[model samples]
Target: MAGLLAAMTVSLTGTRVSAIALPWFVLTTTGSPAQTGVVAFAEMAPYVLVKALAGPLVDRVGPRRISWVGDVVSATAAGTVVLLHALDLLPLGALVTLVAVVGAARGPGDLAKEIMIPEAAERGRVPLERATGLMGVTERLAQTAGPAAGGAMVALLGPLAGLAISVTCFALGSMIVAWALPRGMGHSAPAQEAPEAGQKGQEAGQEGYWRRFGQGFTFLRGEPLLLSVVVMVGITNLLDAAFSQVLVFVWARESGHDAAVVGLNSSVAGATAVGGSLVAAAVAHRMRRRPVFFVAFLLAGPTRFLVLAVDAPVWAMVTVFAVGGFAAGFLNPILGAISYERVPRHLLGRVNALRDSLAWAGIPLGGLVGGAAVVAAGLTPVLLAGGAAYALTTSLTGLRPEWRQLDRPRRTGPSVVPAPRERAGTTDGGRAERSP
Candidate 1:
């Protein structure tokens, strides 16, 4: 678990450093905000596209292998960028292409790591929720560290130095994955079993990649509770992107606060969020999933926009955002645990890839949509509408019948493993079988 988590944090830190450095590099080089946006888009589009398409490949080839290759690709690309810049050979087109490659490789690498978490938790004999909380902490720490390191490196040494740091991080991540983890830890069992391997070969011969992808869709479609969670979370993610990208900046600027105010508010919120994840890790097993999920969403989702709608004082806004980020911290651990518990071990890679891609689809367009809406309808109206939508998405969606499944207690005692008969009815490969 430590090995995997370390690898993830390092890789994620590299990615986040790139997020900061790449924009600054582009802006300084071209002196065009338009080119910066284009570079950003170039990276993210390939990321989403590759992730959505890589599920079956991950399932077939194994996540450990994919993760290793992904890191290598990213490291090579980042290193090449550094070399090209030093040689004065990196044109805008080449830079964009390299960034796109890094993004494309990172997407599956991330998904592959995600697919390994449940098994890692089981091996560690820790509860899934706690394990996920730890995973969240790793991510939060990376998010906090990456930008600060990136900015300092860029300012003191230059953007090439930042890219060089990114390359080092990626290489270190790859080394950890290659040397630290046990052999075949993240690979599927069927790949090693002769009979299962034969069966897989037969299936592959019969069904194409699209068919395998469609199988994930079919599984998710039959599970209404999961569907509800995905759609609701997807909408919230869209709202969050908008808030982070456009609304908050506008509010800070219009309210006569400097960028430092925004940074301070975000730093407080992020710190509290880390604390919340640690708390969740400690007490999650004792808590009921449904109420915790609902309350977290209620506090975290709509409240920020609502607070901004009234144009509250900086202190009030900071307090609201801190509380909201803290509440939000609990959300992912619960969701991640539920997802792992419900999905079958064999299908984890494909299903998680597809589900995550769908949920994340709205992120790229969010800033564009928010800016357009602010232009057409103005900021206050947008905030109010976003707040209302978030409330409706969470509150109204929670009333649906399928959400009751979330209330099922964590299976305890010696009979943690389900019998074959008990597992027959499950659609999504989970231990608990669901009746259609």
Candidate 2:
């Protein structure tokens, strides 16, 4: 468990750092917001598609292997970018291609780490919510540290230096997963289930890849609450991608600030988020999920955009971001717990993959839309529009009947619950339990 978390932290930190370095590099070099958006799209389009496809593979081959291999590929791609640039051979086209490779590899790598979390929690004897909160902390810590370091690197040395650091971090993450984890950990789903179910499980193992993928999709389609959450999160993620990839960078440049200020904004939010994650880790299990989720969304979503849209003072902007970050901290743990509680263990990889892919599907277009909007109407108007949309989406989504199930108690054993339209069964030890 410790090894997994450590590996995740290192990898995520590198990704976050690159997020700063790559966009800044593109914007400065091209001096075109549209090109910046294209770069972002080049990366995320492959990320979403590959991730959606990689779920069955992750389950079939084992997450540990997929994780390490993906990291290695990502490291190579990042290193290529640095090497080519230093050699004066890197073009915008090449840079976009390399980042696309990184994104493609990153999809499975991140999903593998996420798929391992429930097992890690079980091994550590931690409750699901706390474990997810800890995972959130790990992410928040990366967000806090990565941007700080990237900003410094970009300011002092160059953006290339930051990219170089990303290469090193990816390599280290690969090594950690390859060598640090215990043998037999993160085994294939079939191997893990075979002993318990004997021949029946082995038969299921023989199912084709597309069949397995279809099952995950079918299962996800049947869950109304999960579907609603996915849709809402998808919209928010799109806005966030725009905010981070284009709007904020443009805001900083237009406001006569540097990359350091950008880093500072993210780092402050991340720092406070760590505190929020810690608190959630300690007590979220005892809290009502619906209110907390909605409240957190309210604080986290619209405020950052509105603050920037108004061209607030740096101090004021930072303060709002800090508050928003803290609120955002409580979100993932609750969502993760709910999803983990609902999905059966054997289906974790595919189900989570589909869920995450759907939620992230809009991200590839966020930068494109933001860049075009900025070109058409400028930053402030776009920010205001995004903020209003965020506020409305989050606020109105809570009224749905399905969201009320957010507070459902965690089951003691595996959730063998069938989809809504499936046949309901008695509460026997091994039957298909009904969805709410």
Which candidate's lDDT is highest?
2
| Best prediction by TM-score | 1
> Per-residue lDDT tens digits of candidate 2, residues 1-436?
7898899889988997898798888888789977987887788778879988998899888888999999999999999999998898989889889999999999899888887888889888998889888888888888778877887899898888999999999999999999998768788877775556666677667778998898788877777777787888888888887898799999999988887787778878889989988999999989998899889888987999999888899899899999988888888888788777777776778888888888877766787789999999998999999999999998899998877777875442342323324311100000010000
Off by over 4 Å in 2: 24-37, 86-94, 246-263, 309-314, 371-382, 410-436
In candidate 1, where is summed lDDT lowest over 10 consecutive residues?
427-436
What's each prediction's clash count?
0, 0
Each model's TM-score?
A: 0.91, 0.87
Prediction 2 global C-alpha lDDT: 0.81
lDDT string, candidate 1, 1-436, tens digits: 9999999999989987888888998899889999999999998888878988888788777888899999999999989988998899999999999999998999899888877887788888988879888877777677667888898999998887888889999999999999988886876424532233455545543446776677666666666766777787777778888988899899888778888888777777777777877888888878988899789878876888988889888889889989987886777777777777776665666667777777777788889989999999999999999999989988998898878878673332211111222221221100010000
